[model samples]
Target: MGGNLSAQDEPASKRVAAALRGRIEKGELAAGSKLPSEREIASEYEIARTTASAAIRLLEQEGLVLRQHGRGNFVRETSPLIRLGGDRYSRKYRGGPTPFRRECERAGLTPRVEVLAAEQARPPIEIAQRLGVDSFTESVLQRSNLYFADDEPVQVVNTYIPWAVAEGTPLVERKQTGKDGIYGRLEDCGHIMTTIREEVTARMPDHREREMLALPGGTPVLQVIHTSIDQNQSPFEVTRFVLRADRNGLLYQLAVD
Candidate 1:
């Protein structure tokens, strides 16, 4: 927050935050570097302590800084790697149905689902193929949205389940259970998902998505297709996840012989 009084720029507090952010971005401040105290900033900038404090709050909200109770604030490290993919429905984190929420929480991220629309509909061709069912068969159509840090829409997932399997189950019944995972809820309803296979591809964004994701013209989306199966070896669900690559980093480990 320390700067000259005649700092001919936007607002004084914004100028201060911008200067600090620039320093951090340029590695001058670096991650984990403690910011100057409020009094020091006020003295250096010839501004009031309140201005210095306000600058910190703004940076924190922008995800540019982290404030620890007694440790003061520092630039937040860039978004963490998102590790996904694992054994399906093994009760790895929770014994009940949904463990995905637990996994996300353990990674220090908030997860929520907004039901866009859910009802019985014939499976789309691609989804029908993945689910190993006839395209004309009625399936449970569900759309759930996902939000990430800064309230950005990182992923939009559309899922399909056969009504015969998900009907009357928590998977079909939308709930406000913030902590429950859909997989867990499905298990609770006796679906007992046992495995999943996934496919991934990347492509340029179409006009609709560019607007929905608020992306510039050139950014591409990472498309993931997943088919999950039950213990009976029957395909249970098909999910298509469209993720914003800039905000999400997919992690995978490779083993070579």
Candidate 2:
């Protein structure tokens, strides 16, 4: 079947994709529901079969549909929403469940963490500068972590700590930090946290990140650089968190001065 496209200036593929996307977002196409076949879509939309295929590809890139080699296209399941805010750093939450775990629990989702690495490593120039260490210093501890919500990878975190601060503590181990996270352990070491500084940016994920997070093409990620400061006004930790843009919402509660 064919139809005239003179009325709409947009490309045929885009129009078809838009229509299908709306259906998916409106829940007309439930998660895991199969999409119309290329032939069916082409006949229904009165577009070329190739154009219908391209439309499905577009939805795949947008992470709204998954196309298996033999199983045909299907609507993708939604991910849990994570809210990142200042309250996660409160002392009350520290040394209990990890902030990530707590957030997932609050959302009624299972939270899982895989400790990728925890070892002493040379810090990057930016991290070294933030920690007030010389460029040549080899005394930094790095902790790399992967967080999953409901078994879906959602975020990657890399935290750097000055060797002087983490040398004699569990921070140097690759084991769980118990109820208290790194911040709690630091508190036990006489470094009381006072403030946190965060810088947020967004960009498309690099190849490595895309593979690690199993992200779809055209999906962007949120990069958050966090600096933890102690009561002495000294920066004790620098953490880089890469969050799946589709799965997280950041909230900042600012005081009106």
Leading candidate by TM-score: 2
Q: For each candidate in turn, give its C-alpha RMSD to the true structure in angstroms.
A: 9.6, 3.6
Q: What would the TM-scores of all predictions be?
A: 0.60, 0.90
Clashing pairs in 1: 97-183, 97-184, 98-184, 98-185
- Model 1: CA > 4 A from native: 1-81, 87-90, 95-109, 174-179, 254-257
State the C-alpha lDDT per candidate. 0.68, 0.87
Task: Candidate 2: list runs displaced more than 4 Å.
Answer: 1-7
Q: Global CA lDDT of candidate 1, please?
A: 0.68
lDDT of 2 by residue, 1-257 (tens): 67765638788999999999999889899998999999999999999999999999999888788887798988877655666577878887754787888889888889999999999888999889899976686779999999999998999899998888899898888977876788878888888879999999998999989999988666789999999999889999999999998777688886787
Model 1 is weakest, by summed lDDT over 10 consecutive residues, at 95-104
| Alpha carbon lDDT at 246, candidate 2 | 79
Model 1, span 1-257: residue lDDT tens: 97666657577898888887788889987777788888888888788999999887778756567677788877665554264565433455564434445445656777655666666778888888877777876765564655444455566677787777677765655544333466655666666767777888987767766666665333568888888888889887888888766555565554477
